[model samples]
Target chain A: MKRYMPLFVLPTLCAFILGFILPFIMGVGLSFCKFTTVTDAKFVGFSNYIKALQDTVFRHSFWYTALFTVVSLLVINVIAFALAMALTQKMRGTNIFRTIFFMPNLIGGIVLGYIWQLIFNGILAKYSTALALNEWYGFWGLIILVSWQQIGYMMIIYIAGLQAIPGDVLEAAQIDGATGWQRLWKVTVPMMMPSITICSFLSVTNGFKLFDQNLSLTAGEPGKMSEMMALNIYNTFYGRTGWEGVGQAKAVLFFILVVIIGVLQLRATRSKEVQQ
Target chain B: MKKKKVMPVLLAAAMTVGMFAGCGSNDAGTAGGSTQGAQGTQAADKSSGDGSVYYLNFKPEADEQWQILASEYTKETGVPVTVLTAASGEYEKTLKSEMAKTDAPTLFQVNGPVGLASWKDYCYDLSGADVTGQLTSEDFALKDGDQTLGIGYVIESYGIIYNKALLEKAGYTAADITNFASLKKVAEDITARKDELGFSAFTSAGMDGSSDWRFKTHLANLPIYYEYKADGIDNTDAIKGTYLDNYRQIWDLYINNATCDPKLLSTKTGDDAVAEFATEEAVFYQNGTWAYNDVKDLGDDNLGLLPIYIGVDGEENQGICTGTENYWCVNKNAAPEDIQATLDFMNWCVTSETGVNAMCKDMGFVIPFKSNLDSENVLVNAANDYLDAGKTPVTWNFTTMPSEEWKNGVGSALTAYAADQSDANWDAVKKAFVEGWATEAAAAK
Candidate 1:
């Protein structure tokens, strides 16, 4: 088996290098150059980066995305955890409830954005306003949209973690005269740290990389005040001529920021995991 | 146990080999299929003595007509012509990605000089081409120094399209409203009697993406046109919005007299406006000749075109806005035979009887070529009447707009102002129009 490792690994290695690694490297290189098409690139060094940073819209989107990620991460994880706890208590018809809750996750982001747009506009029309008229409306609209789509998925992960808890451990806590809340906090939560780490990491990263929902919901309307980082980069790349290099630079910076944040979050959460 | 171990190993080895075979066969299959396809086309081209044509069309509304025309041309001439239309509002993005392909478009279009700037290197000079000779006027040809980079194919006119029957019921004729002052008086009168008359003065000035271009680009063009006329310039890097107040009055008229609440305009669509006019729920609709198909059910005699009167000084002699954003250009990088074929096809499109009929009648386009046939479209005939009367048609200077981003900024400002109707919001619209233009223009440089 050991000797056959090279043969087994070669196919996947080739695909990874060709599909992901090469384009990623080329993208980073192009960030420092200005060109419409890849064949016509001319190196301009830090100018692209300077232009990206100088853009007030880009800066606004960065802060907007940061707040969105933090708020969404907390909301999604807390509600999903609570739902998982309730559903795992030998409740009747839990499967039906779980399926119903998870159905929204199966819908496409663009579709969800449009459906919710109609619903939100229909309600807001009573007030004689629209979602695109104000930035805060767009912000809260996206938050609600994303939370609806992602909460079900996170709940499934939490459910899996809950079901995996050893029965004997809870029995031991009970024998020690532990109450339900105490058993949950001391024994179950400590034991569930591994799952918590994985769930948090996924939710945090997903919150930052969100684009389709943000785009279809508001499209950075009311003068681009609702744009997030990913959508901002996309608009820069496609919407503005002579700004492709700046868009590429923004993408590279976005990648680095997401990576650093993801790493720090993993480290913080992984340290809390206790051995079974 | 040894047999089981060997069987599992054999299965694993087979699975890996199958994966390799799958990858290898896909590459080989595509390579062979494409080469075969290329050879087949080459053989057909050789037999026909002409290269194939691939036209990347810009208009989605005329896509079906283009497809039929292409098939007919191919049948008659034995030259393969493929037509692909980009989705509405996605032409530039589609063009950029398509131009990067190996089998890029042989024939394409640019909006105007600003659009031609990015694709200048890709454009084949049409100065001495047969299609260039067919153009009715040099004004329709986009030039760069000595080279004719593109030729305007369709001439479209946009203004306040009104229902003649509805206007008569409101006790006014088309002649009674020749300028802004009279137009305003009539519209205000209609609005005052809207409840009794069972129709409003104008359709909803929708601010949704589908309808906002009517205001942001077409309506916005009025101010730019007046400024350009004052400066005696065709294009400008920075705009002095001299006629913005006129723009404000026209916008105010449209929203205040409309069939819907101003606050709900952002949710309305182009379809809504057209429906309002077609169903006779409104007296006026701000759109172009292309909207004829949507509202033609009201009968030809009931329709008329009125020049958008925005209270400009010259006023009475102003015709409807008549210009084009669609300009055809052959790709310079195509094979020489393909380039020649594209040029020949373009000339045939403008010169041939079948082509002219298809364009003018079927597509309802007022083509800008010498062989252009008479249009049956009522709105088009109305436009020609304006031109015949020697009214100064406002040229489309909106083509020189810096970018789509600038339009969006102004559009949002306009929508916000529509919702609030405040001075500060109107000031924001002015800032977006003037300052955003300057910023975008400098960035484009």
Candidate 2:
């Protein structure tokens, strides 16, 4: 198998180098240069990085993305876990409930954003305000939208974890006079650590990487207040002429932030996992 | 074990076959493209053409007409003319990518002075070009020092597009709206009788991405235009808030007389605004000549353009905001043959019957070049009437707006102000305009 590994790995290695590694290197190089096109790039040192740091909107988006990630992680995992536990119980027609809950995940993000925008505006119109009226409105709107779209997916993972918990453990706890609540806290939760880790990591990264929904929702209306890190970088790249290098620098910073957070989260979660 | 061996062999065979197939198809595709190119050159060669014309048109709305014009020119003269239109609002990004290619466009568009500054390095001097000679007035030519960089293609105007029947029913006419005070009275009276007349004074000037440009870019032009006039300058490095009072007056009138609440403006859209005007739910809609096709069914006799009578001194001299931002620039970096081909194509567009008819009739453009055909666009006619009446048409200096980033900042500020109409909020909007412009200009430099 080891001898044949090179043949199997060659195709994927070639694709990764061509598709991801080359472009990523080029993009990193561009962050240090000033040019309209790659062919005309002129090295400009750290000026782009300096300009990117000076951008108030870019700084605001960093804190906004951090808060959003923490909030989304808590909300999505809690709701999804609750749903997963409830659905795992011997209830009539649990499949139908699960299917209905998960259906929103199938819709495209842009389409979902527009549909929710109309719904939000319709309700807000009664109060004579709108989604773009306030940054908090857009923030909360995005939270609800992302939670609605992702909860079912996380719930599926949690359900699988719940069912995998050995029946003998629950029976043994019952024989020892352990209550339902005690059994859940001691046995079920310990076993579900892996699922919780996966779900939380996913929601956190999704929160940070959000773009299309942010754009279609508020598009940083009310003075760029609700712009996430991705949208801010995009707007800087295309909206501000001659600032493409700074935008690229912002993108590189965003990539580093996401990578650091992801690795830290994985390590923290892995530490809490029980042997089971 | 047998399955694994067989699968690997099959995969290898499939990969070899796929490689061969890919090579074959690439050869075929290139073969077809070169033949088309050869045919195009043959046609150009027959008609004293030196090179083929590759036009990167900016307007998506007129894409069909441009495609027809390209094909027609190719058929007539055997010159290979290709027209590729970028989606609206994506022209700058598209042009940036396309200009990096080997076969870059011979012809492209610049919004006005600001756009010219960005592309000045690539712009061919049209001072001695035949197309420059065909231009009706040299005033429409965009100059960089002694070099003619771009020539205006079409002149368009925008203002308060009112329903003539609705205005008459309210006991008002276009002549009554000579100033801000009179225009306000007419809109107020009509809005006061909205229930009886079955139409309000103004359509919803939505602050959504689609509709906000009407206010942010066009309506904002009123104050910018007056300030430029007062300062005796065509462009400025930084603007003082001299005409913001007039801007506020006009904005206040628009929001107060509209069919939707100011808070709800963020939810509304340009399409909704157009629908309200088309369905006669509103008496006034703020838009430009391009909207003629959308609202012409309201009847040519019943539709007219009125000056945006923001309370400025000498308001009677104001006409509809009329100017050309759509200027054509040939690429100097292109091969000389291609440049000459582009020049010839532009001259033919102005002087030839087919090109003139396509631009004036099919696309509803009021060409600034010396074309014989009269434009059939009713909005153009309305603008021409204002010019004949000796009204000084307000120039669209918004084209020279510092940057798109500045526009977005102002747009966001405007939306915020619309949501909460207060002195503090308006100050923020004003700051975003004045300060944002300075910041963007410095950044652009």
Candidate 3:
């Protein structure tokens, strides 16, 4: 089996190299060069990186992305966990409720963004305001949109984790004079650490990576105030004529930030997970 | 272990199959290449009649007409023409990606000088091309040194599009408005009598992505045009903004007299403004000849084009801001055969009757070519009326606007001012306009 393992992994290994590694290497290489096209790229060294740092919009988008990620992670996980806990208990029409809660996740991101934009604009119109009128409006609108789209997905994961826990452990805790709140905080939550880690990681990364929703909803309106890291990088690449290298540099930085934060979060949460 | 061995084999076979499946599609693309053509001319050997043309069209509004025209040409000439229209506001991005493909677009567009500057290397010099001779004048051609990089395909004019019935009901006529003072009086009176008259002075100046160009690109042209004129120059590296005060005056009047709130301007879209004008909720809408089709249902007699009176001196003699941003530029990188075919096809489009009709009627375009002499669009006719009167046409100097980044910066500043209507905000807008221009120009260089 060990001798055959290499053969079994070869296909996937080839695919991973072709699809991810090659492009990533090329992307990193391109970050150091300046050219309209790949064939014409000339090495310009750290100038692109310097430009990315100097860009006020790029810096603003970093902070915006960080704030969005933190807020969305907290909001999404809390609500999703609550919904999952409720659904996991013996309840009427639990399947229907689960399906209903998860339906938004099925819709495409662009479609969700547009649908939410119309809904938000309709509501804001009453106050003689709109989603694009203010960055805060755009920010909250995105958080609401992301939560609506992702809560169901996180809830399902949480429900799976909840169901996986032994019933006897919970029953024993209850029998030992444990209150509902105490059992939830001490046993259930500690037991749900794995689920929390996954959900938090997903929501946090999703928040940072958000683009279509941000674009369709506000498109950095009220003057690029609501532009996130991904959107900022995209705008730099396509919107600015000569900033392709700088955009690539920003993208590399974004990739590093996401990876670091994702790893840190995994470590922080993984350490707290109880051994089965 | 046996099952695992079989599974790996199956997965590897599936992967091989998928690779072959992708290859199968590429084979189809080449085999079907006979049918998938563009602008009708890219084949190296023209006598074989296998020449195909791929035109990446810029105007989203004219896309349908272009598609119909391409098919019609293919049917007549036994040549295939493939027309791909980029969504509005995404042409540059689309062109960049498409041009990198093996079968790049033989025909594309450069908006103007600033756009030409970016794509100049790819542009096939049209100086000696067949279409060059067919041009009414070389004045509309964009020249980078000795090379004619692009030629204006259409001439458009933007001003105050007024609903005639609403204006007449307000007890005013076209004759009443000749300058800023008169235009102001009528708009202010109509606004003041809004309760009685049931219509406001102007439609909402939407600052949304779709409509911001109306203000940021077109309306902003008024100041740029005047400043260029006053400075006795056609284009400049850095604008002094001599007429920004006049720009502020017109913008203020627009917001103050409109039915919609100034703070709500950011939310109002171009469609909403069109609806307002079409439904007669407002008398004035600041748009261009392109909007003629959208508002034509209001009846020709009911619609009129007036100069955007921004209180510039000797402005009574000023015509509507007139010129074109769209220019046809052939890809220099394409094969010579494709280039020649593109040039021939471009000539045929302007010279042929079918092409002329489509441009003037379906697209509502005032083609700059000598072949298309007349246009039926009322706004176009109105523009001609201004030209015939010897009024100086405000050349679209905004074509030289440093870049989209600068335009966005200015747009943001303008929106902030529109929202707050403060002196400090106006100053910020001024700074974005003046200093931002120099900054962007330097960056572009």
Best-fitting candidate, measured by lDDT? 1
Candidate with the larger DockQ of 1 and 2 = 2
TM-score of predicted structure 1: 0.93
Model 3: how far residue B76 lies from native, Å: 4.4
Candidate 1 chain A lDDT trough over 10 residues, lowest sum: A3-12
In the range B1-445, model 3's lDDT, one tens digit per residue, is 6776788678877886776575454421132122222233322333554556778887877777888887787777766666777766777876776776677778889889888877888899889888888788788899999999899999989899999899999999989999988989999999899999999999999887778899988889999988887788887878998999989999999988997988778777889999998898999999988888899999998888999989987999999888888899998998777787678778878999998888877887888888775777889899889999999888898888988888998888888888889999999889999998998888777
| Segments in model 1 whose C-alpha atoms lie over 4 Å from true places | A1-11, B1-50
Docking class of 1: medium
Ranking by DockQ: 2, 3, 1
Candidate 3: list runs displaced more than 4 Å: A1-18, B1-15, B23-51, B75-79
**How big a share of the true inter-chain contacts is recovered in candidate 3?**
0.48
Give one digit per residue, the lDDT tens place, for model 1 in B1-445: 6666677567667866776776664321122111122111221353465687878888877777887888788877878886777777677766776676666778989999888887888899999899999999999999999999999999999999999999999999998997899998999999999899999999999988889999999999999999898899988888988888888999988999999989988888898998999999999999999998999999999999999989888779999999999999999998998898899889999999889988988888999999888889999999999999999898998999998788999999999999999999999999999999999998877
* DockQ of the two-chain complex in candidate 2: 0.56
- Residue pairs in steric clash, candidate 1? none
Candidate with maximal DockQ = 2
Candidate 2 lDDT, A1-276, residue by residue in tens: 577667666655665776699989999999999877555678999999999999988999899888988989999999999999999999899999999989999988899889999999999989888898789999999999999999999999999999988899899999999999999899889889999899988988999999988999888877789999999999988776678888999999999999999999999998889986
